[model samples]
Target: MNDLHAVNTILADHLRIVLVGTQHPGNIGAAARAMKTMGLSKLVLVAPEKAPDRDTLAMAAGADDLVERASVFASLAEAVADCRWVLGATARNRRIQLEPLHPRDAAQRALVAAAAGPVALVFGRERTGLNNAELQLCHAAVHIPSDPAFSSLNLAAAVQVLSYELRCALLGDAGSAGQSRTPPPTAEVAAHAELEGLFAQLADTLDQIDFHKGRAPDSAMRKLRRLYLRANLDSADVRLLRGVLADTQRMARIAGEASVDKKIR
Candidate 1:
């Protein structure tokens, strides 16, 4: 295949656009059309308010095939489970413990990640955007520098903006690109599922050891998650951490049992 065709195929297969809890069916269709124009085909929908309807088909026009091919999941976590890198697009100024990336910079990083494994750019619902929990699933937040004075961008328009940036990055026209983080050759960065599993084990282990004392573990878990995500750990790293957590849990259980035995004696 030619160079152009090769790059196109790689991007189409490796990079996905995920929409979480999209409210309007029409917006879904419009977003699909925007993706098609930028040579993107993979689309994942997470628990939309309603199934695609006539309005959706009307908006997609010639891009109806993308709508038909789109994968639907019950949750954003499930939708991005296989993706190695996930970036959440946010318009809200809400605080999240994730690294923020400009649209252009996000595109560059995404292209680099796509070489290692499937990468995703996640867009949340039209009305409210992604909640804190959903945003946390992403490794970074991608923000478009629209005018702060009038920053309301249409759902489809937002998709188009990111799509265009991705296309530019794919074509080697990304100007003043941000640092591109290449995944390690020894072991590519872990998929979303692996990272999530590590996070779960860490949380459970912390609980077993009474790391939180009486306080809720939510705040601490969030910080821990951010720390690990920033580490860009691969599958080996995840396995090693999980092993440590498992041992910690076992040790903690043994200590608790010994204490109980002493009290009984």
Candidate 2:
């Protein structure tokens, strides 16, 4: 019990819960309440449709402090900009095959990431949930197992379930942990902001060469994002990839100019 308590305390510091495009202020308060119960205090809301009000405070019960301290962002990307690992809470399967993890399994993976840097668990809007673009930002998707007859879980309920699993994972009783094995050396994963910059550079380079060729670039970019995110690129990896993209762009521009000169000659 003592070991579990200590683990929970330390893990809490590295975990952050992000609510994206939240529609209800009450859900924010409820989520804060749930987080506090599970030893989590870092809460971020991205572009909430309704800011916290009197009802929100009332719903928070005794966890108003968490609600008060919660930071708000203008977008999902901005919310997780500094986080090294992002997990999206999604129940639906999209066209792209995202690695779907059960809540407990997700918690174990998240704990590993938290050991390296701040990790974010992102919950999408209450109505539509995370869109394709928002989900693309995440490295993986976490789904809470619910009865197929009535699987729809409330936003706050989903947060509570995931938080509970995380708490259990931290407590060292989660079955996902191996009993006897040497843990591998941890990698310093690049922050979301760095990955975002790399993605932008890649898009620009691809455009310069007309790689899309009238096809919708969103599909190709989304696939690329998922592929690289799964690779869990470290700082060195990001730098190397960005350098390649930069050189590609430079070469494309030079080739374009040479073609123009040849036409004139």
Candidate 3:
């Protein structure tokens, strides 16, 4: 085996290709072929509307093994729970708040996070693409700057593009100035599930304190998520934040009891 291929096999193993709500069964097989061509093998299907049939196998061609071993999940969160990094691919400029990265840059970022744990590159349906809610689960958005005059990219094509970029990233030449690969020490970075737990605790803490008062909490939580995610929090960071939230919730309960006693008096 070539030295580069040998090294990339390990890094690529940590990366997963996730497809959500795919409409056509053939696209699933095509997507598998794309991943296989670029040395990617892990495929995750999330609640596809249709089932794979004969056409699916026909499209897979020589990459049937990837399609055969693909993991299926009911939800995106459950699918990516163990991942430390996730990048959602979309063409439309949705109302999502995540920082967008070009395919080449996104590949670099994904590879870096692969050092710590599993990383996911998510692609949504062919028509509607990923919604804001699903994008929230991702740390960043991957956008391909195709011609605006004709931007309707196929699901399998999009996977092929991103997979190619990942392969180029592994080769360490992505055509971006100042582009370099230095896999940072990811020893302490929290896993995807850990970050999700922190957010859940934060939401509960805010509710206990009535922090939103009369306003909607979703907007606030969204901004807070961006802030924390940008900070690239580690395991110790999550623990500290969770500890503070627990204390705040405890204080809120105590204050609520005191208010009731005063009202009674």
Candidate 4:
């Protein structure tokens, strides 16, 4: 296998970190240290309240490189834009209608997803945890197993736990040295524009069927789009759905013509 692909394979087996709305520079420093300790390097920061400075560098110690190299984004969407799978790290349930995974299970799933493309585990603010809006962006939520009575985890500690799980899942005891044959390149999925086009066609068909007349149909159509987007439909799937919409519109037109003929008779 090519060296670049092999290296990516190793990294792909691991998990990535994204700190959202982090409040303290020291915590960011410590989180970087924790990540490096487990052999993970990718760190993304989203709208951090404090800037990384001398204080952060001093705290990071040997992991200063990670702190310095971390990518900063103004928005969570930008931070996770390239990620194919996103996991939200939280102690309390955000209750945003997503399935919850324990840290270990989430790590395993993240490993698999990473092989296909970039994946991210997002950590929320030190104070309030991830909000419902942020949690909705994630494909799933991960809760570190802790005492229910008092389950708050320090930011660095949370990173350590999840990063450790990811490292173990990726490297095992022997480490990620001997793996061969790079996995197939992850196929590029359909873009949001393509999906939107399909949704528009679907809504047009629904209108032909009189499905959206009296009942504010836009809401229902939006929900349907959400459901499909969550499924991560590929190009082939989008084409198939478009074909189904075409057939539905054709049938609706025929039915309407037949009704007009009966009325005239």
- The lowest-lDDT stretch of 10 consecutive residues in candidate 2 is 177-186
lDDT of each: 0.88, 0.86, 0.87, 0.76
Across residues 159-253, which tens digit of lDDT does each residue of candidate 2 receive?
A: 99999988888876787743312131155888899999999999999899999999989889988887787777878999999999989999999
Model 3 agreement with the true structure over 222-259: per-residue lDDT tens digits: 98997787777888999999999998988999999999
Top-scoring candidate (TM-score): 1
For lDDT, the strongest prediction is 1
How many clashing residue pairs appear in each of the predictions shown?
0, 0, 0, 0
Query: How far does residue 221 in candidate 3 sit from its true spot (Å)?
Result: 0.9
> Which regions of candidate 1 fall more than 4 Å away from where they truly are?
179-187
TM-score quality measure for candidate 3: 0.94
Task: Give the least accurate 10-residue stretch of model 1, judged by summed lDDT.
Answer: 178-187
Give the local distance difference test score of model 4.
0.76
Alpha-carbon RMSD to native, per candidate:
1.9, 3.0, 2.4, 6.6
How close is every model to the real structure, measured as TM-score? 0.95, 0.93, 0.94, 0.71
Question: In candidate 3, how many Å is residue 33 off?
Answer: 0.6
lDDT at position 236, candidate 1: 86
lDDT score of residue 98 within candidate 3: 83
Model 3: C-alpha RMSD to truth? 2.4
Clashes of 2: 0
